[model samples]
Target: MNKKQKKMLIRILISAALLIGFNFLPFGGPLRFILYLIPYLVIGYDILIKAFKGIKNRQPFDESLLMAVATIGAIAIAIYSEVADHENGDYVEAIAVMLFYQIGEWFQSYAVGKSRRNISDLMDIRPDYANIEIGGKLEQIDPDEVEIGSVIIVQPGEKVPIDGIVIEGESTLNTSALTGESLPRDAQEGDEIISGCINMTGVLKIRTTKEFGESTVSKILDLVENASSRKSKSEDFITKFARVYTPAVVYSAIALAVLPPIVRMFVMGIPAEWGIWIYRALTFLVISCPCALVISIPLSFFAGIGGASNAGVLVKGSNYLETLSQTKCVVFDKTGTLTQGVFEVNEVHHNEMDRDDLLEYAALAESASSHPISKSLQRAYGKQIDRSRVTDIQEISGNGVMAKVDGIDVAAGNSKLMDRLGVKWIDCHRAGTIIHMAVDGRYAGHIVISDIEKPHAKEAIQLLKKAGVEKTVMLTGDSGKAAEHVAADLGIDEVHAELLPADKVSQVEALMKRNTGKGKLAFVGDGINDAPVLSRADIGIAMGAMGSDAAIEAADIVLMDDDPIKISKAIRISRKCLRIVYENIWFAIGIKLICLVLGAVGIANMWLAIFADVGVMIIAVLNAIRALFVKNL
Candidate 1:
């Protein structure tokens, strides 16, 4: 507990003891009242002072004001009835009410602290120091002082201090803190590693690529720290509701206290019995505090955002979290979002020469270019090219490449290039790009290359369907044949093929219009071209690991590990948070309304009013804390 909570807890203990002892004393009248006043002042003097301050400041209808008035009025009534009627009255209930309210306040503070700790634990990624290799020796310095392009040595069991490429050494990094995946990832020389991953085994020599402030860890921290500033509609509604609700109930309590007594005396010709009616009104004021609904609703969203961070999903704010739960349509970019965007040579067909010779000619012809298909051919050849044997290279845009290999004119392109060469080529029946070739004016075989779907792409679509997504669409720049093949493999609902970047945005906008009512549409992408469509969607989720900076900046949610499955997880977290928010709202308002009526009618006492205010608040706070535990979900 904090120091203030500790002090309040001690005061509550002392007041409870005094209240119990004074209640059992044989003393009566003034002596009994003096003893009770000691405990009341000890437990509730701060509340009375705050109430007075609120009144002096022109904002008098807060919970403190209600608490102060309710307890003080009850005490005054007790003293008057005891002295005039020689009847015993209870002041113990007044002290007990204040004591229990303080207890509830302390519980709330503790729960908020616990929820903050969960988020702070995930933010332990900030490295204290970076070890730079200076003068052939490692020197520890502030991470901010470490300049880009400097080589930093990361030892085993240390955080990678900055984003960089591994120039030397190898290690298994534990990226669970960054990616929420428990598996250790193997990193070797030439592989790019981001900051915040712990080097689990072997020392690594990393050449820094980014400054400390621009690192992934820094960006994530900034995102989470500012998350609470953007409040959801639910939070805003509660704020406005409390503003109107608090004063409305206070005036109603006043009318209940004054109007009925006047009607009894004047209109009905009966005795007012002011003491009984006034006591009931005091109980009514105590029961009408809006503490539970005001406190628990925001706490629920904060905990939900923290829980999502723990699972490697960064929600920009509570408003996006609220919107995610209502997503009924999910649009995906085909490459790098649903498919592994890497190209590989799938097969070699229609070979007039040896298959090895066909691959060699293709690799050599495309060696001067750096397209994905070119890289795939070079990778499949698995050997360094003899550039001396090749000369007179030419690149045909939208077709392919042509070069003179071994002083022979060789052309390696698609059907268009072959048509220009007047060489008869066979169209391979396949689901990938078919590169037809001609060697020395004769038809050569074709090599097929294709982009493969991710291993979990099908499962991700299935889970989204199971999670209540009504439409799952894909937009891609690939040909109709290739796009449909991958979409069918992944069970995508619809496919918009051969689209440009602008066309992708149009497709997303059209899909968004199709979603009516409260249903929202979400777009997930990982390329730089996807930024526009991402910004146009209701929820833009980016693959942080391999995504472009523009796409990440435009997205509302980020999956740190580039996993499609976390999309469903993010939605689930948002749904759970909204569920808890609605529950607290309805539950708190329902109980308070019922008890307020009972208290005004004299069917409920001050003790029951305390339960309605503090007890319900404590229960709702505990329910809000449940949003922090999302390990299973």
Candidate 2:
């Protein structure tokens, strides 16, 4: 407990002791009333002052108003009946009730403060500067001042400050900050490294392709900052309920006071004291205040969102938190999502040329290229690169590289590369790109590079199923063969590939159309090419450090590190939060309504009414706090 909690705990104990003493002490009438006034002012003065302030501000219908009226009404009975702390209860009950209510409020306040602090901590991950390589020298510059196409030097042990491609040197980057993987990935010339990753080993010269604001890390932080502005369905309901409920209860308390005495005077001819029932009616007002509902419900959502943000999951609002529990189908983007979007030469086929020779010659031909597939081949070969071996290298954008390697005309890429060379090319009957290598326009061999499936990708899918996702679909712009290979490897229920960005959106729309009943559909991606699809789905989730700003902004949920298993984890957390929300809702309303009916009929006294309102509130508020520490979900 924090300082505020500690203070409130002491206040509660003091107020409890005072109430106990008043109940059991052998004090006379007037003396006991005067004695009770000491602790009453100690515990209830703040409520009284707030009530006075609200009345002055024309906002008198608040929880403090209810507390003030209830306690003062009991004191009026003490002054009039000159009663000691005898019979059913006294002002001691009133003081104790408000004191314990403060205890719940303090606990809630502390938990929310902790959660908000976590969100602030997430903002610290955003980088401040980029080391740009201007001309021959490196310079430290503000990330925003670094324009696109600038070369940046990412020395070993430094964080990559912008998304760019490697032009010189080599390194292994610990991309765990983005992808949540434990392994470090190797990157050589021509490889694209996203910003926000720490380069664990070796120096790297990267050509900044994207501006600083457009970098992956910057976008993730910005998305998290803006997530809470959007309100959820449950949040909206609570807002409207507070507005209508507070006024209605206030009016009911007025009717309870006036209606009883008027009926007795006109119909039954009894002397209408009005004070007896008016005091009961005032106690009714106190019980009906609904502060517990108003305060704890929103506090629960605030803490849930904050807790989720700390774990690197950005839930846009409490509504998404509530909807997450009802999710049935989860659609996943294959590249950079379920699979390591980084492609590597997993298998090599040397139909005639030596495998190492083919790779060395292929890397040499593609040396001048700045593409991920080319970089993977170079990294795989890891041979002493003879730059002088190649001459007249022409890089055909979106196709392949052509070069004169060791006096032989070498070309490497897709079927289009073979077609451009006017030679017969062999297709590798597998998924991923089959880079067909040709020597002097003769079909030499082919090297297939594919995005390797994530080690936890299959397990993540299994966990999603176990967590109750009915369907797991893979949607990608990759080749059908590659999509099938990845989907089969990861055990996805459906695979759709060879799609454009627009086609991915259409697929999500179709998936949403086919969803069973009112179940929600969530589209998960790295928040890059799938921005539209992510926006179209019921819930859009982005993964890792490489996620695009557009994707993160468009996505409803973002995983700070690219971990497929977090999909299940996030769903589980939401389920827990939603369960707690429902429990608070039912528990608060159920107990309050029951006690309210009993109070009106005179079967329940003001003491039980205090139990119904403030007591149930403490229990529900405590239950709502359960969502904050439930990170295990």
Candidate 3:
């Protein structure tokens, strides 16, 4: 709690002590009225001041207005009972009511502060400064001060300052900060590192290709800050309802105060007695304030969004959160999404030579190279080659690597690499391309390299259906056969293959047409081409681990982990959070309904009406706080 909350708490404690101490004493008459005033002033000071300000501003139709009317009515009752009825003070009820109402208001403020703090913590992922190279000298500068094309040195255990290319040095980066993936990714010379990733080890000197404001980290912070302003359908309705609700209730309270008194004076035999009905009318205003409903409902949404941010999932706003809860259809992109974006040597084909020999020579030739395909070959070999036994290394971009291993002119790469080496053709029809190796200028063997599917891919499909996704689809630019094979393996219901980014968008549009479309359809992707489709879908979910900025920006929801299972998990969290919000809304309304009927009939007094207002708010606020504990989701 802040200093203000702390002070309020202290005041509440003092008032409680006074109220309890006076309860046992034989304090009666004038002395008892003074006892009640202590708690009343302790709790209702700020509220009374705020009410007076509203009146001065000529906008006295808020919750404070309701509270003021209710509080004054209690004091009036105390005075009337003492004067006319020859009774002791009833101001204890008045003070206790105001005290409870203040407690509820303080709780709400703290709850809102907690929710805002949650998002603030997540926004802290962005780095504040960067080590920039100026005139060949490294200098620390504010991230905002750094411009494009500046070299930024990111050392071990430090965050990458801006999205840039690695001009020098190599390291492993733990990208959980940006992408929820726990695995550390290998970064080498020329590889691009987005801002906010921690360099686990090794010195990386990067050239800042984007300005600080335009970097990946800045955009993320900006997105989170503006998220709450955009409203979901439920939130929008609540806002609009509250606009008309306050004035309507105030008028209703007026009607209750006036209409009954007039009827008793002229239409009935009884003389007009304003005191009894006016007090009830004030109670009616207190019960009808709707503070609990207005504050807690939006607070629930805020807490839900905050909870999601803690899990590394960024839902743009309550609108996206609401859409995610209603999602029934999920579509995914193939490469770098359902499967590991990186390519690797899955199989090695050797017709004459041993498989081990074919791999050893291939690793030696490809070791010095930096391309993703080369790295896969080197990893597949799984051992270091004797550099002393190699000579005549050459690189052919878009082809393969060539070298001399133990005086034999060896070439290992794609079919392009083999054709350049003038090697013989080996007929092989397979799912992925076999990298044909040429040993001594003759056909040796082909090393088949391809993107491997994520281990949880199939399980993610089952989980999605189990978690209430009605349909699953795959849309990709890969070969039709490859797309079908992946979709079949994963048990996805629909597959659209050999599509460009634009085609993917159209396909998604067509699917949107096919479904009754009651619920939203979300597209999941992590590649540049997938960005367009990701934007077109009702809610775009991006794989943050490998996702491009285009995809992340276009996406409504971003899963920090590349795991597709997180999608279902996100949906589950949203449904649960939203359910809690609805529960608070109903709880508050139910109490108000009972209190409204009772107060109008004169059975419910000021304290009971305060319970209907302040007690309901406290309970509802407590319920909203439960959303922050949904990290177990």
Highest lDDT, which number? 1
Name the lDDT of candidate 1: 0.87
Reference-based lDDT, each prediction: 0.87, 0.77, 0.80
lDDT of 3 by residue, 387-486 (tens): 7888899876546678899899888766656676667667556665357789888888887766778988899899889988999999876555667878
Alpha-carbon lDDT of model 2:
0.77
TM-score for each candidate, following the candidate numbering? 0.88, 0.75, 0.79
Better of 1 and 3 by lDDT: 1
Backbone clashes, candidate 2: 2
Which candidate, 1 or 2, has the higher lDDT? 1
For candidate 1, write residues 78-143 as lDDT tens digits. 888887789877887778878887778778888898788878997678899999877888899999
515-550, model 2: which lDDT tens digit per residue? 848699988987766777888888888877354566
Error of 1 at 203 (Å): 1.2
Q: Report the number of clashing residue pairs per model.
A: 0, 2, 1
Residue 474 in candidate 1, Cα distance off native in Å: 1.1
Candidate with better lDDT, 2 vs 3: 3
- What lDDT is reached at residue 392 by model 3? 92
Which 10-residue span in candidate 3 carries the lowest summed lDDT? 544-553
